[model samples]
Target: MTNTTPQAASAAESATAKPALIERNGIEIIAEAERTAKPRDLFWPWFAANVSVFGMSYGTWIFGFGVSFWQATLVALIGIPVSFALCGLIAIAGKRGSAPTMVLSRAAFGVHGQKVPGIVSWLTSIGWETFLAIMATLATATVFAKLGLPSGTGVLIAAAIAVAALIVVASVLGYHTIMKLQGVLTWITGAVTILYIILTIPHINMDAVMAIPAGSPQAVIGALVMVMTGFGLGWINIAADWSRYQKRSASDASIVAWNTFGGAVAPVLLVVFGLLLAGSDPALMDQISYDPIGALASILPIWVLIPFWLTAVLALVSGAVLGIYSSGLTLLSLGIKIPRPAAAAIDGVILTIGTIYVVFFAQSFIDPFQSFLITLGVPLASWAGVLIADVLTRRVDYDENALFDANGRYGAFDWISLGTLVVASVIGWGLVINQFADAASWNNWQGYLLEPLGLGGVDGPWAYSNIGVLVSLVFSFVVTLLLRRGKIRRQEAAPATDGDN
Candidate 1:
């Protein structure tokens, strides 16, 4: 006879219970039973998302700042890993709170005040996902053209629709599904990427690369800022989303280490390789500025083009999937009354629309978009600085109940944090200049204080030196550390329900 005892029946039920294919959790604290992820699992998503050949395009961007091969190499080495380490620091908040990053900011900014940065985070996520989708679609069209297939307007539209659909489907399936997908993609994409590097090695001219002259100090700093903003700071807003599932018992150091390792390893190598390729051929560098992934495929052997295109597109989609997933949670944290799947679907639709516009309608979008991102980076750096300070100052776990309760220990608004964010952003903007000639008029508002500070006007020697981004980060971090410590300590010490898993 079958086992009928209570223990045997429970065992049978447990063995048969499978996790839902679509995750339903939103911004709420994750249930203890579901917090089963390990710190090492973080490596898969970070590595997969970052392993895209597009990173090679950053070499072109760095070179545009007038830096030489060795100078750019130094910038890439320092910028990539150091920037990602910040993401690792932010991930600590996830393990402590078991909530989304924006939601956890409530302890520092209060429930209502957190919305300001939350909106910025959401917009950044949507912009990045749409950008990736557009890249994938373009990659597909380029590869099809190289194969002698008809690559017309219709083909572009079709590719966009297809890429958008893949990204949407993966994102709507949510966290657990993404984790498994990312892990598998990491290996598939990593191996193909290696093969691509081997085939392209012959194209690299070390003699020409070494012959290029070094740029000015201002240009070197600009290159460093671009590298950081492009790689790590670009994704910091969503860093914690991947870690919310980590077991509370996971070591903090291990969490940071894995997060840093997964994110930094791929880009550091790719960018250095890119430096070699771009340095050898100025024409290739120019092409990369306009079409990163597609231009990358231009140099490949026709036989490898097919696999290169496939891996390239998949890598872009993998990164977009992570963005959309976190964007969905961010939407929820904004007080949207919808299920997680629906939020992801909503962001996916927006992404599709944005991709269509960028791919089909927008004129001279690339340079302007690059300038826009750099401009936005200042405020984002300010936000990161404040949040990092809050994360480091707290001694106790985030109070789960208080995170949602404005009337509780957190209150309705923390004016000090709000003021710091605003002041830092304003000053940071003044210190920066938009070097892109094609940038929109509004972007011209920057560099107002550049003349006053004797850095020369927007067209001066320091024109492209975007030291403002660094200033914003340091200014906000120090201010918060000095002024907000007591408030953060009080919040930590206040009475609340136990949030420990």
Candidate 2:
């Protein structure tokens, strides 16, 4: 038998504890052989790519719908700053830890239990990618429709081909190439929109803005909840996903700062822009035109409008392809094991199906997302809350190997964290359900237990919807803290148990 010294063992443990990679250029990128090429390889490109992704095809219609310019601006101004602050705080951990969102799931879900959220992230990516693809195709067809072109199946065919080609190029070129193109398009989109807003400022409908609906507080709050879910969380919420590719290192604080600032500013701007144009009598499709392209056409000369509109379409498709490509990579990371090209092809096909359903078949743009938010979005958002709690309370930072290992520091199942998630989700959803139950029969339970608490019932704040994401999140965070605190008590009581045993 051989005996090892305690000092040697300690040294080995210390070496194992070191982080795998360092931060660079405000990105928490991994060390690799083939680096990002120059120009597009830098931070501004990455920043631009991210901004373009958030700047969408239906921005004008969605943000501007039903609200005055100032009112729409009010929502963006107030909502964005609050939401991004949370994202920014989380981004700091990602930058410092150099972990993807799924990788960070280990801390909250347990080493072995990570597969729960991992699969959720993967599935969500697939669904959202498909939805975006469909929307892009629809948007493109609408642009042609506005031009008095053929409004038949030919439009769908052309849009599909265009979107698929863009996705193929983006997937093959990978991050660096995408970012470079994103930088150029970002400037283009921004320039056109800013110019259009300035031009259209004179046409603002001040009275109509004041008349925008406040039909029910429940609906308004529900919409606000949706806004938060849309902005704050994503299928792949990892801050490091982009930052990991940066060329230089910055503090965790810096990453959070940039993410928060950008996130805060972008959505508000898009929504506010949407509101400014809300009073236009154009068709819904026209309202959400790829950008200010058609609107610009209305404002500018025929010669200039044609080129500018084309640029807007190019940028819009580029942004959509980026989403598809990113989601495909995320799917691959989830163990799809297919080559990038092959996976992108598969994603493109699925996206086509989703696009058709959303754009051509569906009556409303927000319906699918609303459904998704209540069912899938709430649970995933709950997962985020639990993760934040775990990171803060447990301090159970897994080493890289442990991140991959099923039975490392985490048990076969971290029942504590899992239990907290399940309980919080059930209770939160029950709040939504109890609202629709027969009121006269179960009125006591519904009104007394659920209504006042905003769970469910006639006057309940979150009735007829499975959207207690905020409530679930708050409950999950509280439960996690209690469990972690209980753990401390258990440790203290351990010696007493030994004596009793």
Candidate 3:
């Protein structure tokens, strides 16, 4: 009805063609007003994104490790919120700098110092992508076997590759698409989980749940630490990766609240579910040690189980996509010259092979998954401390262009951040390894450190509730503050921010 000029028509077409969020390629500074999202718009996407089997496996650890129901619940209560608290804070950090989370760390660590966190972030992303991909693939292969399809190593690897392909597609599409799918998945996963809860309810045993038989303090504490490690420290690294797209006007408190609630809800509920099922049948519980999927699958009917199976497949994609997407952004943080989609594709290929190897070739898949959690807890925890402290102290004022330019103000490296990581990592690892040696099984993952150091003993005070990570966090925080405060004073004394400053 109305005539439009050619210039106006072209502009309209360009606007329509653009993605709701995530610019072309993967990691670049997001310009303001580009795909701005609100706080509530932020919540469900994150919440549903986490409604996967990974949380189930993590929660299963609480019961598998012999923690009582109430004890497991307490740890879940404390640990999930604690981890998400860091996540929420970091999510707010997402707003301050329009770059990915790791990129923002450059401000605190300096240009050169940024590489340390970048490398760690990339490795974690790739590791998780491979791990979840393998787990989800194997779960799907099991379903394949049930459908009269021949199942074996070959079939398993094939299924894994299929899932890997999906991850690549989603990650290549980038942030907004992933979040949109997550919104749909929230309903899908919730429906399946609700059905699971219904069947599981009749079997709930009050005696088992309330039953607190004889247990030593050492074992109890160890269980709590492991539980916290499972749900909390494990996820703190990537919290801000999702929240960086929020509208600049989004309130920090609102972001923190929604992020915390969204992140905490599913894991806590699922862990309690695992605790209940532990009471119903102890034998099925043992299967968790070997096959977490099969063990849980054994609980539901074959018909109702389809939805659950689909959840695993979708969950794997959701989880892996998170890693792949972040890995792309992380590559950019490395100052790599590659485009975002290419970076993500490269990550996807490596993970595809890794997933196949871990599924078919590795002696076992679960141990590595378990070991990485505690092993990573130390360094990531330390980084979290330094990162959050820097953010709060500086009030999230960042100079973006300088972050990429080595010669720019942030400097090639900050000796303080690097030095803090080294010292904190050593201390934190020692505390964690000592705990491992204390609880050393036949194939102790930490045995390499314990035997050489001769630190063998029973559980120590630091072993309880991931105090090792806590110690690393507190130590890093204090050291960063003291170091940064002096640097600020020196900067005031001199106009230029020299290496000393």
Scored by lDDT, the top model is: 1
The 10 consecutive residues of candidate 2 with the worst lDDT sum are 20-29
The local distance difference test score of each candidate is: 0.88, 0.52, 0.69
TM-score of each: 0.95, 0.74, 0.87
1 against 3, candidate with superior TM-score: 1
In the order shown, what is each candidate's alpha-carbon RMSD?
Answer: 4.9, 8.5, 6.0
Local accuracy of candidate 1 as per-residue lDDT tens digits, 274-392:
99999999999988877899899999999999889989999999999999999998998888888889999999999999989988888766787778888889888999999999898
Please estimate how well model 3 matches the true structure, expressed as its whole-model Cα lDDT.
Answer: 0.69
Task: Please say which candidate is ahead in lDDT: 1 or 3.
Answer: 1
**Model 3 residue 166 distance off true place after TM-score fit, in angstroms:** 0.8
Model 1: weakest 10-residue lDDT segment is: 1-10
- Give, for candidate 3, the lowest lDDT window spanning 10 residues: 1-10
Task: Name the TM-score of candidate 2.
Answer: 0.74
Alpha-carbon shift of residue 451 in model 1 (angstroms) = 1.1
CA error at residue 445 for candidate 1, angstroms: 0.8
